[model samples]
Target: MNILLKSSVLCASILLAACNSDDQQQSQTSSQTITESKYYQTKTPYQPQQDLNKYEAIPQGFQPVFTELVARHGSRGLSSIKYDLALYNLWKQAKAENALTPLGEKLGADLESMMKANILLGYGVEGIRQFGYGNETMSGIQEHRGIADRLLQRLPDLFKTASTQSASILVQSSGVDRAVDSAKFFTAELIQQHPQLKANITPMSYTSLASSSVPTVEDGGVDRFKLYFHSLNKEQDLATPLSASQQAIYDASQAYQKFEEDDAELINKLNELAKNTQAEQIAMRVLNPLFKPEFIKKLGTTGYIFSNTGSYTVTAPNGESITEKGKGKNSIASAVDAAAYVYELYSISGGMKTELKGIDFDQYMPLDAAKFYAEFNDANDFYSKGPSFTESKNVTSAIAQGLKQDLFKQVDAIVDKQQSHRAVLRFAHAEIIIPLATSLELHNMMQPLPLRQTYNYSNSAWRGEIVSPMAANLQWDIYQNTQGTTLVKMFYNEKETLFKSSCNYARYSSNSFYYDYLKLKQCYQIQ
Candidate 1:
């Protein structure tokens, strides 16, 4: 017979003997069918979108002026510039159109009060020059402009809240033209007092500088100039003998401040209007259709089930039982909604409970006795070859051996999992075992080598094991007088050894042990 064919036949014989039951054959076939059925279904993927412009309430006269100011002061810091510009522009537009609501009026008044306070708090013209336009200015126009850009990008709700009303609508529709005219007039008057200011008052650029390295004129350079004017206005109030042109610039700055503040109020009122509008409600609503039973069944056939108990039993067209098992639960069309609910609950609550209090499994055992018996039989069947056999001592023995091997594999797996644990163990062995073994080997190697035998060789000092070859292991004493030096005394033990011999010149040889001892003692500061 051919070797491969013989081997295949032998393997087939072994497995056939091991699982020779009708039920086992049926179960295996059903599992194979289930595995084959998974390639025929499709599922839709989920996607999420950013929600902007969903707020119900928005301030009036806010968006357009805000946009314009931001356009003018492109490099200004975001939060301050956006808020202040929005406030100022809203106020200016509301006043111009005479469409300011009560809330808009209040917003305008509050902004004016805040601006005056800010100036009194020591942010005047010189202060603006020092910190508003310079490269190092803390609240530079660029910074405020950046704030507005980010607000528009990241906070849509806030944007809508500041742009949803009639006042804002009117401003957005015609605010740009008016703002441009106002800015020109303001700039002209500002230049009269401080000719240097004219150099800095650039027009707002309509094109965005969001992705650019430089600011454009439309990005709110003028608004920043206006802020600088406010600072100048405050300076005029405190200056001694202010010039007529300075006074005019200061007055112009005040007027601009009032207009900006009023525009801010109108913007806030628009936010309220937007909130009450049906548009806002429709924007915020989310729709999700329910899954019908038939649709669920189709999804189920597409691998939507999540759990299995001894496979799925379906009545075939022939009225016979068809059982399926083994493949993992398909999650295609299952309770996706329920799954979402559970996911949200887990997100909110952290995780599921693993332990429950006040439950008695023992008391329920009698009611579950039939299941217990079936489980016992199933377990026995698992351990033995099948129910056809009376017992399976051989199989149990083989299983025990397999378990032992598996346990060793488990230990190896754990060690593989923790690199640090293995490294520490290896380090310990290197530190403890290798050193000890080397020390013993060295000791054995050191012994029996020929040496001068004037010192006592029979004593334990000469015979003792070497703990370490690098340190002192012996001591000696000698006596000396003017006549000569001579051997005096010695001691020997397992811990240490001693020997002494002496010779005389005027002093011992510098290379001799006595000389070395003296030098060592001197170097160590020993007397």
Candidate 2:
């Protein structure tokens, strides 16, 4: 699907591609292994983890009754012009000194195009600023809309019954603009396919609405306290505040903060790891193709200038743009970091595929470099968000508790017939998804290592791309047979995935993905 920079068409899900015979599923799945370079990069776009047609068969007599999904916001622009602004400054320095090689010279156009595309992402042809600032990119809309289409097909009866019974899809979000925008696009597709759902929903129609930055109580779907439960104040998650009922949630957040502060030993280990992992040799290798040797030496010697935490901009004469007003931080950093600034653009460019096409920064950074950086990036995330500390899951569990419980509570309501909502979808960020994934031990995310062992490509399966790439999500579908037998199944990125190892399905059945709902609670140690 093409994501236009300024003017664009609404490229929804490609359903025809999803329908393949079961025989082709294995070959397609094997072809896209995690070891493949395409899957390794952060810019990897959302691919449904499982082929829609090949998911394990639903047990006979079972029908899907309730569904819930916790999705990371869709692909989006850099939070601000941080990467573009930083790289623009570096590119200008190179141009002034005549340091740019043919490859290096291309950075300017790519950055500009990327910046413009980001400025216009999901903004329509006019490129309005309010929703354009770090908002969902066009590819993101495609990802969610496509998922909605696949979902409607997967559980056609649930939606149909919900419409007939007047059951609303109780929506929830982190309340951040991108996440809320994702929710909007997703629900829009649902209504587009099933007009009857219109009467069952809240009065506000988000799918057709313009992007918004305003915090809203209007969506009724938004419950920041549960969806935006992370304690990390460094980003937009804090935009949504805590209510009195959420006051207990603070105890967990405080505990996390206290652990990070008091654990001088762990801090020392992490610091030690950071000092050695620069991969300066690889940095030089990347820069060699882009700049002259003398220029590299000078950068290595003098360091390069970055900025205080803020976004910068380049306005067109046409007055087209998004958020800018960036304040430059006149700090010094190593030559490698400056090169990484290029890598940053290259990495983020993956999400911009729908908007900015045919731009290749991958030529600048080698696959090994990309892999190194991917791991380097994953290491830090391992501690801050993923299961940190080999011994305990303190960091993530604290923040993720509410989200996990929210899942349990909501699903229980459906099972017990307390609520008629067929699908309870929640939109959140990677922070929420990763923590919840690690806390629940989905994939190999449970492996939090000692600081010395550290997270790496070889040792840890907890990769950012596979774990929570653009539009990362975890969906739970509940099915029941008329005999009162309840079963649950999970789809990670829409692929059929098993729960924690202890969680067992019917051993005799051909399907490995389905699990007894009551046994699932016991496996996770849920009361």
Candidate 3:
């Protein structure tokens, strides 16, 4: 996990350490409380774990010949104006009803400020050069820049030759603004450090770098990734909805409550009615009847489950399009969505650069109380994107296959001298990164979750923070010796990681982390 800097590791002297000792003690005291709270997961900037200096030495005589990375976009602002507007409306209602706690009162202003900041940052704004629904934050820029700086340090020999020879580095992005920005920021730092790269960087876009969750007909009417994600759980509940007990705790403990004692009868009736209704509808009905229609609309018209050969059309990277059998939104009420804008309000208000702008709204939310919502979000991802629910095996496989093909193609091109690019960097979403990791059958990511089993960190090591934290990356550094023996070492989210169990080839005499490239490809039948 050691992020090496140019020419040396970061070294600190005794004076600086001693001077910060008192502050470190105070931080430790506060961090204990924050870390224990599940709300810690909800923090806006879920910082990646830092183990910057943990690198093991390369076997003597192996010089880095090529490197490739696939990384998630950096941390970004909340997507869309709808989230801000939705919460603002709800806050207005609470204020008008005189239900605002002192902490709650502060939330309205915070939301406005946050929305304005995002708007200025080009989120949901038109005519901005890099405008997108989710604009990257300054922290995001730093994240990529830091990654670039570290990579340069890690591959000094490779970069030295590339810079001297003026070899181009190919940068690919999904064409989304945040992703494009991530690529730019990363290379910006790279060129800044190695001036020769300024004339040799080429940024490109590949929109279909990953397949859609839904299936589509391919050329010759064949659908390679025909597994429809939504169809698999047409009626199955994927996310665990907030329980009545959890709701009651939020109402009683938080400074704000959506319902009053006078509404006890209505609450009782809604609770009973919720059993047979969709979770989304139940959530809205419990909070405010008037909000049901708008909230549902916000949920979108897509069906809850997957379908085959019905309506949805998926286009492949080669521009071939096949009509999918089914296309729809998920059926389960995203408990996270049922709760609507509440999650964003809590998440963005703390542990972010914006916190310095005077947002401390997390103080209003009790740590233990927020745990349910946090887990609810985790469950949503676990079932939908991770390995828990139906069709995940195929879904993840399909995702990995395409990226794997692209990866090996690049490797082949480099090895065959068909591609001159010394480095290949790809920027995409978590959907791409998570599944690719699963496809590689990386440890922790491959842990089994029975269809009925819910993902809990205590039981499994697959945490979102570790897998797809904003700016998360999987890096493969290829080294070659005088004999042309190529070896590959991988870093998952910057930590040296091992290959999945089935492909593990580390021998007693070899470094456990470094895998022989030929053996790895053979294990996966890549040829």
Candidate 4:
């Protein structure tokens, strides 16, 4: 029987080689062990033949038993072969490159062992079935069938156990339940029951002789082999029995559909967890730096202070004085002397030639006696009293209206001068103070996060003093339009600050005279 199977395998191999040159070439070059034997040689003896008419039907339970056995072993053999071929090719390529490591060699050996076990188990079942009694002669067949029937009833449970175990292993290995072990188990079982009749089977390495069995050869081997070979040819002509259990196993092994769904769910869950963890980590990293005592200490310190004098001074609250009379004498005394000198100069230039040092300039205006007498006489006679009969009552009313108009014109001029003077003072204040104040505010707001550091404004302020001595002029211009309404405009040098500050207090107003005041209030609120 073995010889006949070997001849059939040889013929099949020849036919396969003729059809697929690439497969034959790959098989030859591959380092994977091939377990070929004379088991397919038709000319060999120890084969038996039986007449189809005399042999009874393979029993009703035969299909299911064959299917269960095949499912349990065939899949295992195929998976092992695949793994061996892949590992062998990898090692062979690595060896060619002089890169074969111990790990690679060990993996190759493991795959080889797996393949050997699969092949032995696959063919061992075939050897027992073909050489030993069939279901018609062996009473053990009924018992085996019963066992198979029981196994069939528990198929769902068996599959669940295998799947769970395989999933656990896959998760530990790669965070994915690839079901590789389950696939192997199924492959081994399948190969066991539906062993390819003419395929070669090489003996596997047994751990102990107690677990190994040797096949016995019968006499009249050559003739018997020919008879068995001819009988296989006739058996091929008959309809093959198909098993439903085999189909079910095949369906279950196609795990791609379930794997894709499960994998998506797992990956999504992991990604959500990772995202939350990263956000928390960033918050902690930022918060940790802020809580450091050094940062808090630095923040608590006072900033730059603006003193009144160009140098320095100590003032007593009770109006006491510390008089140091030298080159660094009292600043207040120096300022008073300067003011007196200016008053004297103004008086001399105003045609008051007489020296009047004792006179109080604020209360009395000392002048030349001749000029004063002339001015007093002119004011008494022409300017002060002579407007008595210049016009009629209605004409005087008209004249009074003209005089009121002239007085208003002079008042407008004074108002313009005062506004211009105030603008200069406001610009000076903004230049000296705004930048320092705004910078400090921004520093405080951003210190809690480590996004910014303490600003070094000492150098910047010093540089500004040298270059402009002003924070850079900030001007608020107010004007009246045709509607007798006031409009306000703010400018920093040439740049407008009106709406650019995004400060509510800095809003433009076209109706109220108090717009600049409102804007300053808004700026205060923003800060």
Total clashing pairs for each candidate: 57, 5, 23, 38
lDDT of 4 at 72: 8
Candidate 4 wrong stretches, greater than 4 Å: 1-80, 101-110, 116-121, 127-527
TM-score of each: 0.15, 0.86, 0.66, 0.15
lDDT of 2 by residue, 78-165 (tens): 7766557766777777889999999889878887787777665555521122544487777777899899999999999889887876
lDDT at 50, model 1: 14
Off by more than 4 A, model 3: 1-50, 122-133, 203-340, 349-352, 390-392, 414-419, 506-511
Better of 2 and 3 by TM-score: 2
Candidates 1 and 3 compared: the better one by lDDT is 3
List the pairs of residues colliding in candidate 2: 3-354, 3-355, 50-495, 307-329, 308-329
lDDT of each: 0.23, 0.67, 0.52, 0.22
Worst 10 residues of 1 by lDDT: 1-10
- In model 4, how large is the Cα lDDT of residue 499? 30
RMSD of 1: 41.4
**Pick by TM-score: which candidate is best?**
2
lDDT of 3: 0.52
- Per-residue CA lDDT of candidate 3, range 249-314, in tens? 222222111221223432342233223323343344323422334433433234321111123233
